[model samples]
Target: MSKAEKTKQHIIEKTATLFNTKGYISTSLSDITQATGLTKGSIYGNFENKDEVAIEVYKYNAGLLGKTLSRSFSDEYPKALDKLHAFVDFYRKNWKFVFSNGGCPIMNAATEADDSFPALKNQVKKSFELWMSKISTAILEGQKKGEIDKRVNAEQYASLFIMLIEGGILLSKTMGDQSFLNHALDKITHMIDHELNILPS
Candidate 1:
């Protein structure tokens, strides 16, 4: 990448970690400058303001989550159901990272920006819709392949799954018990396996 692009990326990366740790409003322009080792003028040369840097940081954090989910889905699992399980398993295993880095970006953005920033609130909403769509698509594909029950509602299940996972993550972070996340995942996987099965007793 060019020098400008590299500097921009460096700023984004550093600021993302800070935002995740200190939050948007809590983190100031001076904080960004300190973390990036850049002066106020240099920081402004790369970003318009704290809001601009925050937006980029949010995108960067969300991209990290997206990459994790994508890798889980792309693993060498033989069945779509297995791939879906892997998706949940990945989150369960990485609950520490999720919570430590200021919890899920979607959750953080939803709570922090919903009442303050319209643009950021919209971004969070879009991110959730995209995630739900992906899970729904996978469930539909599994059903079509005879790996899941045709009677099941992919969209509804997807929504429920996301809600449960996000809620579980929130509670785990709040309670300071990572096991809460694992337990939630276990229950979610059980429900999916049972609800989406076609085999008869």
Candidate 2:
């Protein structure tokens, strides 16, 4: 990367947590300058405005979540059933990684960027779809490999799984209790053991 590219990335990385914790509406250019330690001209030189920075920050935060999923799929034995369990296990292991960084970016942005930020709203929507696709792909592989039941609908299960997870995170963050998220993941694990698994539990 060129010097300018590196500088822009430095700004994005520095202010990512601030954007995640503080909504785009509440976060100002001054906040970016404070977090990044960059002058106003430097900030504006890299980004057209706070809105542009927010969009990149959203992508940066979302990439963290993608990494969580990526690691979840990296197993010695990557069966479909195991992958499903890993989905739960990922959040189980990364609760602090997520909660400390101001909760799930898609969830945070989706709730905050409704009528005002169309571009951000679209970004969140695409992220949701991408996450759901990942789940569905795992389910399909499990079904084909005889690890998961063929009768279960992959897309339907994917949506349900995400709904439970996101709801759990929302509650956990709001109540300052990890149990809510843990309980949701526990429920998914149970569903995998009984409803989805073709292997004996």
Candidate 3:
């Protein structure tokens, strides 16, 4: 890549945690300069404004999460049901990575961007839509394979899963207890095995 492209990526990478942790409003130009070791002029040269940088930082953080979760579904999770279980288990396995990166980017952004940052809020909404679509598609695929119950509402289940997981994350993070998330995942697993899973004759 070109020098400018590399520099822009560097800024994004450097400021990702700052933006996620400090938030859009709280992360000042001075903070960006300090985090990226770039002067204000240099930062503006790369990004149109603080808002642009914030948006890009959000994308960078959220993209890393999306890519990581997508990577969880490999040959080990060939079956749709297996993929669902893997999805639930992924949070438990990767909690360290998530915590290190400043919590779930989507959830963090959603909570902060609701009314204040319209642009970032829109991105968060899109991220959630895409996430829900992925879950619903998986449910649909499982139904086609006769592994999931046809009676299950794919969209509803997808929404429910997000609600449980996000809420669990919020509670767990607030309480400094991982058991909340663990309990939520356990409930999801039970729902999948009993409510969604189709028993073989």
The alpha-carbon RMSD values of the candidates against the true structure, listed in the order shown, are 1.6, 1.2, 1.5
lDDT per residue as tens, model 2, 67-180: 778665566538878778877988999888899999999999999999899999999999999999888988898888888899999999999999999999999999999999
The residue pairs found clashing in candidate 2 are none
Q: Which segments of model 1 are wrong by more than 4 Å? A: none
Task: Return the TM-score for candidate 1, rounded to 2 decimals.
Answer: 0.94
Off by over 4 Å in 3: 73-76
Q: lDDT for each of the candidates?
A: 0.83, 0.89, 0.88
Per-candidate TM-score against the hidden true structure: 0.94, 0.96, 0.96
Clashes of 2: 0
Tell me, by lDDT, which candidate is best. 2
Error of 3 at 108 (Å): 0.7
Q: What TM-score does model 2 achieve against the real structure?
A: 0.96
State how far residue 192 of model 3 sits from its true place (Å). 0.8
- Runs in model 2 deviating more than 4 A are 74-76
